[model samples]
Target: MGKVGPPITGLPVMPSDLPLDEVPEDVLREVLEEEKRIYRNRSYKKKPYPTSRDVMEAVREALRVSTRIHPDEFPDVVLHILESKGFEVRHVTVKRIWRAYETLVRKGVIRDELGVMM
Candidate 1:
């Protein structure tokens, strides 16, 4: 065998550098909270999606055209409609559409007569 290097040892390790199992729970929680705070402070480059009102309006229009479909199809149909209108449909957007649908139903903006909000 060729010459081997000496086994590694003797490095200064901070408390944060300790193995996860060795770190105290309180310290880990503090570190996690700090990381979250730092992340929230960072600026993001992507453009934000359309306002909730706009999304809700799109969902309403889509529902109008899909009146006979089952209620469970609402999110997927709305996503397709939004994408067809040149909006980027993300999972978040789909979730927002479902939430807006519920809000509209609670506010009486969409009615069961129209087969839209039920």
Candidate 2:
């Protein structure tokens, strides 16, 4: 809350001020200790985020089923499938999956645009 370094013209004071050599040892030490405290509170790799590969897997899974599905129903099915499988399904994720689905359809990865197996 207090001013950290020399108050120049209109610049806000921070621990790592312009003159690296001029900033006092105590201020640098404070910043280091703060950083350490923040690091200590983190959950390191405990709950990792889903990667693009995971989303691709979900997209493939959603479209690979034998049943016929309409393009309009893709988002709901994708959400259900991915969420049930423990992927963090967001709006953007569903959009990505839909685009991937369309891409696969265009490239003949999926047999039909309407999602029919035949």
Instruction: State the displacement of the C-alpha of residue 33, model 2, in Å, after optimal TM-score superposition.
Output: 24
lDDT of 1 by residue, 1-118 (tens): 2333444575554545445575588988999999999999896675446678768888788778887777677778877777777665664455677788878878888865335543
Worst 10 residues of 1 by lDDT: 1-10
Residue 37 alpha-carbon offset, candidate 1, angstroms? 39
Q: Candidate 2 has what TM-score?
A: 0.45
lDDT for model 2, please.
Answer: 0.66
lDDT of 1: 0.71
* Best by the TM-score measure: 1
Question: For residues 1-118, what per-residue lDDT tens digits would candidate 2 score against the true structure?
Answer: 3435557687786645555666689988999999999989884653335665666666678667726777678777776776777656554455676666666667766656464333
- Output the lDDT of residue 14, model 1: 50
Off by over 4 Å in 1: 1-48, 113-118
Q: Distance (Å) between predicted and true CA of 27, model 2? A: 38
Error of 2 at 95 (Å): 2.8
Which runs in model 2 stand beyond 4 Å of their true positions?
1-49, 91-94, 115-118
